[model samples]
Target chain A: MEAIKDKKNLQVVINAGWCKSCGICIDLCPKGALGRDNRDKAVWQYPDKCIRCGLCELRCPDLAITLQEAEEEE
Target chain B: MPVKRYLRQRFFPQLWCAGCGHGQIMASLIRAIEELGLQKNNVVVVSGIGCSSRMPGYLDFHTLHTLHGRALAFATGVKMGRPELNVIVPMGDGDASAIGGNHLIHAARRNINITAIVMNNNIYGMTGGQSSPTTPVAAKSTTAPLGNIDPAFDLVELAKGAGASFVARSTTYHSKEMQNMFVKAINHKGFSFVEVLTQCPTYYGRKNEGVSPTEMMKKFATTTTSIGSPKKKENPELIERGVFVDQERTEYASSYCEMINQMRKQK
Candidate 1:
């Protein structure tokens, strides 16, 4: 179970170092895939809910979020 | 290539205040360059002194951080010196319209092959929230303690009046639209001017009733409409955002070369 969860985490990566906790991504997200962590940074709280729509990635002003391509696993 | 490849990773956590729209503009620009498959070496990003001017430093492309309001001037020189290279100038509202207003008009009049992206944040973010030429009437700023009485310059009209071949406008809320506009402007052969209505949340927002960046972006989405939308007919006051002018013209660099070639033939 832990291995599967770790593998799924690679789908949407967020760089906390670059993130400024602006909340643009969370507010603009269509799927509500992102939520604020304890530190007020964005995190993929519900990875299953994400459709990989890339809106969060596109709308992130900080360039902290990157939606990995699904084909990369092949 | 990925958009990350075009960025200088060392500059992460940019100097802009949280939710400042300039970062979104930069992101759109990088995505546009990537979509166009432009060579990094062939591109030059130039900027004048302001919050928006800091963009060139973050990008990995050939960049020039020039004097205040003189980005277009320096970009003109770069374009003329190497006609094949793509030159992009990102400027702040004050940097473009107030101090560099003359250069802006002249650059457009010359029909030079350069892309100018004016990140219009209404106030001078770098200078402690002073009113700029594009600040809306009745908007309060540090300089305008009561309310700004002066009418703002319509940048789209101004660019068209100055003879820019490509003129467009988009707000930060419409990031996708902005990216597409950037692609089109960069592909244009003559002078291309794109005005992006960004937000200076820290200074401009706090001065005017303490509006946050999210609220500012929401206002942009509600107050602006696309060109030729029926809503615009119903409400003329709604600011129209889209490509205003796109036409082929004899580019300045090409015309100069042709003149030189004709003179050489006569000699």
Candidate 2:
């Protein structure tokens, strides 16, 4: 199972297995929300800075990255 | 962008190599479709055999994974049968230029309303890195160990000369540019063609000594000037990437449909 973090309705999931750490998304992120961890996998380095622009989600070559609004917790 | 709505999550992660540019191209395509708000039911994605051909399977749309190098022919039939569907073909360099070269030109000449996105990765990735028609003269491939002597085919120029109404070029390094080109090509009515430079990091980058995949991709940005740039004149080796040709022309399906209607009326 993949780790899905709910950062205030921002559901972000990083499938580390498929990630090749190309740094394309990391370089293109307008908000500087993503960075490589010790394992060389893409992680949400600045979750608070996430503007939900979808640039990383749309540009990820591996599809290892996913970003979506959290479901309403009503 | 609700990309998950259009992508098949069952096939969650694609099979492309980590640094492979195909996935980026695929993402741009999906974004373009979403931006245009084209429904999956009405948009038909067609592809020929190659690593790139696998795109349609992951995309949630009316797709046809056809024979090797025969995607244009298959797309032609689809447009003729159902002229309303937006047919988009994602072909590889070998798929578009080698075996399917003839069909490519004829489709352009007929001015079919299919937006053909040829992902020019230079080498045949699926076939274990053989030299393709678009491979540079000095590039080393499995088949060309001594460095290829053949001249590369300029796909953009080929499409323009073949009478395609819309022609453009962009590398996978430029994701936004690629998506924008797709938007314009889809908006264009007749034989729209875009040659996207996709890097096959596994196969295309192996033999080149001291050249990292990142460096190679950056070369696309530095080497190419847009169509109207005066810098294009300064550097002949620079690939001029932009919408080179766009003009009003009658689309194949509409014209054919009109002819069929005329015949029926006479009868």
For each candidate, report its DockQ versus the true two-chain complex: 0.53, 0.40
* Clash totals, every prediction: 0, 0
Which ranges in model 2 have alpha carbons more than 4 Å from their true place? A1-13, A27-33, A46-55, A67-74, B209-212
**How large is the C-alpha RMSD of every model relative to the true structure?**
3.5, 4.4
| Model 1 spans > 4 angstroms off | A1-10, A70-74
| Residue-by-residue lDDT tens digits, candidate 1, B144-223 | 99999999999889999999999999999998999999999999999999999988889889888587677888889989
Judge candidate 2 at residue B241 and give its lDDT.
81
Candidate that would win on TM-score = 1
The worst-scoring run of ten residues by lDDT in candidate 2 chain B lies at B207-216
- Alpha carbon deviation, residue B16, candidate 2 (Å): 0.6
Summarize candidate 2's per-residue lDDT along B1-267 as a digit string, tens digits: 566788887886788876778998888998899999987899999999999999999999999999999999999999999999999999999999998999999999999999999999899999899999999999999999989999999999899999999999998778888899999999999999999997787888876543555666767788877887889788887888878899989988999999999999999
- Model 1 docking grade: medium
